[model samples]
Each structure stands twice: as C-alpha cells, then as structure tokens.
Target chain A: MSAERQERIEARIAQLNAEMQKREDYQAIIRLQRAYGFYIDKGYWREASDLFTEDATYEQGVDGVFIGRERIHQVIVKLSGGNPGPGLPFGQLYERFQLQPVITVSDDGQSAFGRWHELAMLGQYGEHAEWGEGVYENRYRKEGGVWKISALHYFPNFVAPYEGGWAVLKPVEGDWRSPELADFPPDAPPTVNYKPFPDQFTVPFHYPHPVTGKAVA
Target chain B: MSEHLLDALEAHLDSIELRIARQASHEAIERLQRSYCYFIDKGLWTAASDLFADDATGEWGQSGVYRGKERIRSYLALRGPEGLGQGELNTHITCQAIITVADDNMSAKARWRSDNMHCTDGTGSWSEGTYENIYVNDGGVWKIASMHYYVTLICDYDKGWIAGDIPMDPPSETLPPDAPPTEVYESLPGAYLPAYHYPNPVTGEQPKKPDLPELPESGEDTLADAVAALSTRVERLEDQRACEKLQRSYGFYVDKAMWNDVSDLFVDDSTLEIGGRGVFLGKKRVLEYMGIGLGPTGPQREQVINHQQFQGIVTVAEDGKTARGRWRAFVIGGSSWAPVNWGDCLYENHYKKVDGVWVMDKLHAPFTMYTLYTDGWHKATTPNTRPESFPPPPDLAPTVVYLTYPNYYCEPFHYPNPVTGKEAPPPNPAAGGVANMADFASEES
Candidate 1:
C-alpha cells in the first residue's frame, strides 16, 4: 500500500473516533436534562426537537409507549397549545432534578443506556398538583455525526391526586403562570379556556390528565 | 511475522479479552448474593463455589493459606463437621462493589463490599464489616489473586435479653437511657445457646412449624409493570453483590477473634484445609482457629480484622434451592507496627440454599499471603489448643487467610421444612430491625 494512502486512512479513522466521542458526550448531556423533566416544563420545543432526531421515537404517558419523532412533535404542539417555546418558568421546570443510579455507556463509546429521576408539580395535568415524579430509561444513538436521542421511555414513579382542571392554558390578566406575558394578544386576553388543539382533534396515547380528565395529547 | 511476535500479539489480545470477561464476571459475582441472599442464608456451599476459578486460592483464618484446585478441594473436604455443614447460623449482608473493566480486558479492579455479618443466635448481636479486592483474568478466566477485609464492628450476644437472664425492658422512653454500662456492649466470646436443634426426626419431638406466610401474588400484567419488573431483577442483581460484603464481615470476626461466627457462616459439617496446615472440621474447630489467630498474640494483634473490600461470583440452582459462590476478600487489619495491606487474598468459598435462604456450606482460603508487622512472638504452635482457640497472640496469626470461605455465589440445597413443607427464610439480620425508611436513613446518614 502507498504511504500517502495509509496516512489518509489513518486520518479518517482519527476523525471518526473523535466524532464518536463527541456524539457520546453530547447525548449524555441531553439524556441528563431530558430525564429530569427540564424540557417538558420549560417547553423548549425547537431545542428539545434538536435533542432528538427528525425520526426519533418517544413515549411519556400512562401507556409508556410512543414512536416516531413527528408524533413527539405533535405531542409537544399540544403541550405548547401552538406556542413555539416551553411556557413554564425556568425555575419551576429545572427546580426538581435528580440523576438515577447506573448510567451505562456502551463498550465502543458510541451509545448509552441510563435512567434518571425527577420531581415536579404539573398544573398542565390538573389543579396545580405535583405531577412530574418518576424515572426514565433512555436509549441514545449517533446520527449524522452527532448523538441524538433515539428513544425516551418515561413513566411516573408515583401519582398524586390533583385539584385544578388540567388543560393547556394561555395566561390571562392577574395570572403569573407564564413568563412570556408579552406574547399574549390584547383582544383574546390569554384565557384558561383556550384549547391548544381543536376540541375534535384526536391525538394518540390518550392518558387522562391528572386533573382535567382531558386526554394528555 | 516471526511466530514469537505473533504469539506475543495474540497473548496481548487474549489478555485484553480476558480482562473484559473478568470485569463482567466480577460484576456477576458482586451481584450473586443479593440476587439470592435467601439461598445463601440457608448454607448451600456446593452451589456457592461454582463462582470461583477452578484453581482458586484461599485460607481459613490468618494461619493457613491454600493454593491450587487440589488444595481447594482438600479445604472443602474439611469444611463439613466444622459447623458449616447445613442449616446452622444465618448469614448476614452488607455490600457495595465498584468494578472497572480495562479496554484490553486482561485486568480489572473490583472495589467490593466487605460486610459479612452473622447471627448464631436468634437475637441482635451482629459481627459485621468490609473487604478489598483485585481480580485478574488468568488465561481467559477472571480469578481472584488477592483479597482482604478490615473488621469494623463485632457484637456478641447479650445474655440479658434471654427469657431468663434478664427481664425484657418495656417500651418507656422515646430515646432509651443514655450511657448504659459498657459491659452491655463488651465482647465476650463462646457459644450462648438453648440448643434449639432442628427436629432430627429420630429421637426428640420436633416443634410444630408455623403456617407459612402468603406471598403477594403477581399482580395484573402490563407492559409498564413488565418493564418495572425488569428493573426489579436488576435490583436483585445489585443486591447479590452484598453476599461478598457479608462474607467480608464474617472474615473480619474470623480474622480477629470470632471463629464461631466465621464457622457459623458455613454449614455445620463443613471442613477447611489451608496448605501447610492440616484440616479442621466443624464450626467448633474453625472457631478454635479464630480464637488463636485473632487472639492477642497473633501478628495482626491490635489490628481490627474485617472485610473492607469484597467481590463474589455466584450461580443459583435451577430449583432455586441450591447455589455456589466464589469471592475475594480485601483485608484492612493490623496496627502501626503491622498495618494490613488494603488489597489482599482471594477467598474461595461455597454456599448452600437450605430451605429458601443462602448460607456458607464450605469455605476455602486457598491462596493468601500476608504483608503485615506486629508485636507478639511468632509461635509454630500455641498452648491455646487446636481449632477452638482464636484470638491468639498477634505474632502467631499468619499474614492472611490464603483460601477464604464460600467461593463465589455457589448455592446449596436443604431438606424442606416439615412444618411448612417448603424452604424456610434464613435467620433474620443480626442487626435486628425491619428494612424500612429508618434503616435507610441510618445507612444514608
């Protein structure tokens, strides 16, 4: 073999190794945040989408089953009620986060499987009851030279009773619920009655909201 | 390429693969007990030794060290009649192991739990502690070359709690009286028992066994529950790691002055034979060795013996009534003059599943070499006598128990409880208390 050809092959191997390492690191960070319910409450749609791939699969309801990144986007659309970003205050979302024990990385360092736990209150589920409290077992993959979440499986550790009605709401007058107050229209003064998806809109995985009895997207 | 060079390359690659296999084996060993502590507590040594390398090394106490498969076999022969035969004392547990696999897979570090505590009597005295370990892949098989344990705590039975020795205290104060007599917690050795032997079915009338408690039936099946159940199995595996920890605790006392408890860790008729030393039989004789080795004159005098680091490779039987375990013990014993090395000796032990619980059936401290200094005079033989006399002068004790007890997670089987007509739970934890929030908080704190 020619010396130049050998050198080129070596360089490609080095590049691929570096890429794999970087992807692994990136995926670990995303997993850490996702398991803690950080993105769910913050409602970071695009960023959350970036964490996963265009064809990523997801499931975070009573059923513990979901597939396809597009479906995840649709679920988020319902979460945001057509809003572009996560609506909850950053403090409220990131407040309760705890990493799980035994985070396992693959031998080749290209993939990882891990679990994490979190605790939080979900007004979206019902009348301001603590909802986000559970562990998540996740699988990640390297895609297009970047690590993206390939699958996220979620379930609550324990469910607590809630009081307030659960339905995505647009903050109205005197409500300190949402930090993005400027985004609301003056004429339709953000009302709790605003339905994100049309009433007839039927989304899959209809886990009943802890409070409102409405399907959780 | 020269054949020699090829051989060297192949050896290196083999070493790497072996290391990885060792790491996985170590992880499995660590989880053996917790996954089947119930089996271990019942004294199943034959099943327990399956976790060990064929040519495992170990020792009984500090006095004898055995090497090679032949010696291990000899040691096992001596385990019976040593009070570790079957259905003797209940094994205790406390474990935590950290395993790291090398990229090449030739060697690995298994930072394991050493907590092996036991209860000879059905009360609260617990002889507990920790161990240390180093696992190497020897010819594609992970074998423990060195293991040791540091004994932290040893609690003997309190005679006052017996039905007659002293009146049972009534629940009075929220916090009990402060500063009770030190004598209450003082270490006094010797068998304290009512001799509640199991029904021999020949001579004496056996006590009627109580009705077996019903287990919660498997609930409705759901995918989520199935996944949760998977985690539960993993949790069980994690708990199995505690078996080595429990052995370590037992080692501490055995290394020190509690030979009976160490013997109790095995089946009643167990035998032990370390190289150089002749064989010892029954729990009583094993205790005699403990009394001498860990006695005042042993070289490790003034040094507390306990399991500070430990690991186990255990396999459960298909019937769930038998198993065998091979483990390593890293001792942390010795005083200023002779401090115990943190990493030492690999203990090859055997276990059994009598009834439903796990217990040590045979223990072989096959290959233990010591590195410690101390004050007492080194004596080839002592006046303290054979097997029963432990706590020998610091100078008399060997540096390590070359072949330790109950090889990796080998499980054993036992006769069914006539009353329940099923396996019985091993004795309760020596540290009496329900496993609950309070215990968790105390452990965390």
Candidate 2:
C-alpha cells in the first residue's frame, strides 16, 4: 500500500475508535441512571446514594440542593422513613417508572446530560396511595471507567391523590429536603417557575428536535 | 518501511471497525425490541408478528406462550380483527433497555422497562412491567427469538394498585393459549420478583444463570482481508443509525402535525394504515388521509397533539435496501371544542432506502384502544367508527371483530414456542382456566 493510503487508514481508525468509545460511555451512563432507579425503588437508599460521585449534588422541586455523597445519602434515608433497615418488609412498595429518556453524552466522553419522565406509584403496606409524575434533568460523570451521578435534579409535574387524579387535585408543594435530614440545603430553586397540570408548561428540552433539528426555544 | 506501516494501519483499522460493528449491533437490537412494543400497542398483529424470527417465542401479559411466526400473528390478531376500534386506547411505553451483544455479534440479550396505559369502554387502567428478550442475527438481519414480559403492577385508574380492590390474577376468558402459563406470579400487593435477563449493570454481579452463548473466535486473517471486512462493517453500522434517525424524525413530525414534512418521509408508492381505517396507498393518498385526520398542515392553533414514540426495534435487511421496525406510540390529542383523548397504538412499519435516504415504505398502526379522558376506558369505551367526510375509505373491512376491555381477546402471535419451535396446542374448553370480565365483575360485586 502507498504511504498516503496508510496514513488515511490510520486516521479513519482513530475516528472509529473515538466513536466507539463515545457509545460505550453512553451505555455506562445509562446503566448508572437505571441502577439508581432500581435501588431507590426497593428502598435501598445506601445503594442508590452510592451511585453518585463524592461531591455530587441532589435537588428536587423547590427543595435546595444537598451537596456531597453523605448528605445525599441522608436525604434518601429520610425519604425512605429511616432506611427501613436493609431488605424491605414483604408488603412495602415504591414503584418508580423512569421513562422517555433523551440522553446526550458530551463530545469529550467525560460527562453526559439526560432528561427523563418519571411516573411513580408509592405507598406503605398498601395504604396512602399516591400517583406522581415528574421530570429529571441530571448530569453524570465518568470516573475511572464507571459513570456516577454528578448532579441530580428532579422537577415535580404533579403528585396527586390516586382516587381523584391530577385534574381534581392540587400539586404537592415544598421540597422533601430538611436540615434534620441533611447538613446542606438545596443548591438552588427549580430552573424554571412553572405550575403543574390543569396548567401547561413544556419542560425545557436539552435536545433539538430529532427530525427537524430545531432547538426547543 | 511502507509495507510495515501498511500492515500496522490495516490491523488498527480492522480492530476499530470491529468495535464499531459491535456497538451498532447493540443499538439495532435495542431498536428492534422497542419496535415490537410499538407494533403490539397498535394491535397491528401482522406487522408486530413479522418482527420475530420464524421460530420465535413470546409470552405477553396474561397470555401464555405462543410459538412460531404464524401463531404469533394469530395471537396478536385476536386483540382486534383489523386493529383497535375508535375511542379505545392502548399504550405500551418501554424504556431503559440494557442490551448486550454477544462477542460473536450473532446473538444478543436485552432487558427493558414497560409501562402500559389502557383505556376502553370508558374505563382506564395502568400497569408496570419488565421484559427480558433474546435476539438472533439471521443472515445479517436481527430478529427476536424470545420475549417474556412480567407484570409488576396492574390496576384500575380509580382504585390504583395500592387499593387492593383488583385481584392479583384476573382470569382470562379469551381462547386458551398455545401453552399453559410459563410461571405463576401476581401483581402488586402480592410480592413476586421477575427474573432478570442480565446481572447488575454496575455491580457486575451475575444473579441469575448466564444464558449467553460462547463467544465466537476472532478468526485469523490477513491485513487486506481485515481491511475489507472492516469496510463492510462500518457501512452497515452507518445504515442502521440512519434508519433509526429517520424513524424518530417521523414521530416528531407527526407530533406537531407537520403534514408536508411527514408526507415527505414516504416514497411515492408508500402506504399508510391507521387501525381499522384501512390502507391509504401511495404518497398522494397518504397526504390526503393525513389532512383529513390532522387538519390543514402546520400546527393547528386550536389543537393539542402529543404523539410520543418509544421502544423502536429496527432490523435492516441483509441486502441493506429495506428494513422493518416495530414501535409503540402514546397519543394524547384534542381540539379547542372537543374533549381531550388519550390512547396507544402498535406500529409495524416498513422502510426502504430510496436515493440514499430512508423513508417509510408502509406505515401500519393497529390501536389497542382509545377513550375520552374524563370517562376513562372503563366508563366509556367507544368503538372506532369511520369518519363521515373522509374520501377513499377503508380498502378492506376489519380482520377481526371484538370489544376492547371488559372483554377478553388474545392478540395473535407471530412466532412459535421458543423452546419447542412447534405450534402450541389449542386451548381445550374442558381445561377450565379461561377467565372473563363477567367472572371478575361478579367477584368485585
């Protein structure tokens, strides 16, 4: 083969390797997000919190951010009613359906951003049934070949009584965050000011339209 | 020196290409599984069944095992004759697909999360589930070999899963399936763990026995041979990605009622079939059909249309000229003067690469059900009826006649039993496992 041809081949090889690496990075990040969901669904708070980086930040709705892994762990433990002590009771359930994900990994392959719709059904001992919907705009980092949550933000669309549905109910307000649960307060308020259903607002998109390539402004 | 350099370059290129091909295979398989959800949601039995291999096996919801492509078709068809009737809604949205391509690149396994919302007869229900599916690369075209869904929670909209008003195992009054239930499990309130297709993604722990086959050898080859192989592999990956983007673009266009753009995604001879409304053959006719249903182009000021497509499973033919995809759509739509409506459908659609661009060759959607938002599926399940002003009506009558919800029907299957590769035995009336709405109603009363 000619020298020029060999050089061209080398360049193409480099490009292909880069693309492959990007894809693997995407897979790792998605797995990290899903692992977090599975752990939280079963009240495995410690396992869920472990999915984050040491200095990661967590925020939901109006609640301020909880910085650092320990604080994040504390928040989850409080939410799960004081850890429920390893292995949930037979009748307890917290089913969170993380659906409709649009994930974008950074060009450098070191970090990624994702937006997901969350549909949750939760209660203890089959009582106090509640239905909830929300959006998660989260950031993930690749640390030593593994992905972990760098910043987790959840915006509530609605948390309503199961019997009446969103239409007949008022939106649940305030963050679940408390000083008793975590040392750090929320990092900041929600990115946008918008009301839940019965009122309509499009959750800002992180991606352009798949077909038109038009940005959601 | 030049010869040595060439050899090194070829080796590097070959390895890169192999990696790209494996990544592409993972993506294509994930899309293929997602497409199956879309097809099954619409009740497009024929289209959905086609996604399976000739010897595929499937177990969905309460339906027992269905083996073979023909059986799969028959099972899905039972959901509705031609497709869902008007006013019924069936939406099966799937996400969180963790796909693993075998080292050989000839087989794969995937795990997915399925969230289903149904409406029929003025009543609505919600369910959450998981799927562990297998795929085979048959002569370069991937096909589903086995699919099993485990329902985690299924309950009425009003009562919810926590209420305990609904039974864990409602009897199925539909025709007996080809085989008995693979395993007995109950939805929420009764704890049951569905088997996982893979170990923990992060922990790398193998909880269940690994069913993956042995990895194929990386076969010895010359530098020239490797270069040639890598070239072909890269092209295939590019084609797969292009096809995925094309289908996703179609969904976005339809969501905003971008009629011209949607029509442009089809070839001149393409066809569009929505539920029992029948087929709109050719691009001109398809455009006309869209106008009738969606109003005159652009975004209609008074209309609110949200049609979301999820779980796209796409398989490009070995020839690379044509492809088949299964998808699920969750639709919520209404106009200023009309009541809001929500529903779901399954899409078993075809695509062809025309002039280097992928476009829809045939779009077929068979809806499971659609109902008004206020009344839900339980209270006001209305049958689909033909629109009065639409011209060039349905080319054929519905394939089957059935009611949605409060009634039991098994959508036909497209593949045979996964293990047997043989037709399932017909249900025997004397066997006595069939459960119907009446049975549940009486129990609830």
Question: Per-residue lDDT of B1-445 in model 1, one digit per residue for the tens?
Answer: 2344333333433332343343355543343323222223334333333334465554322213445544443444343432232113333343444454444556555443323323332332334433344455666545554333333344433311111121222212432222232212112121111111121111224223223222223477532233234333332332343344345445444444445555666555665543224455665666665565445422232345544323344444544444555444444343434432322344456555554345556565533223221111111111212323333222223323322111111111132221123332322121112232222222211
DockQ of each: 0.01, 0.05
TM-score of 2: 0.42
| CA deviation > 4 Å runs, candidate 1 | A1-217, B1-246, B274-278, B296-301, B335-343, B373-445
What would the per-residue lDDT of candidate 1 be over residues A49-135, giving only the tens digit for each residue?
556656666655333233566556555544444443323321121123333222445656666654444333332211123223444
The digit string of per-residue lDDT tens for model 2 on B1-445 reads: 2666466555656555665777767756755665565545556566667778898998876678888988888877766775665434455667646566776778988766666656565566766666778999887778889988776556677654444224444323565567867877654544444555543222233223223222223466633444555545555555655565556556555655667667777767888877667677777777787787667675554444545555455657877898876565666555555665655555667888776667788887766446565554434444544534345575555554433322222232222322223333322221112233123222111
lDDT per residue, candidate 2, A1-217, as tens digits? 4867766775775577577667656555655665465446544455567778899988776566778988888777666555323223332335455565556788788888887667665444324445567677899888877778899888765565545554354433554333344553554554556555433344555654322234533
Candidate with the greatest DockQ versus the true structure: 2
lDDT of 1 at B184: 24
DockQ of 2: 0.05
Report how far off residue B430 is in candidate 2 (Å).
48
lDDT of each: 0.37, 0.60
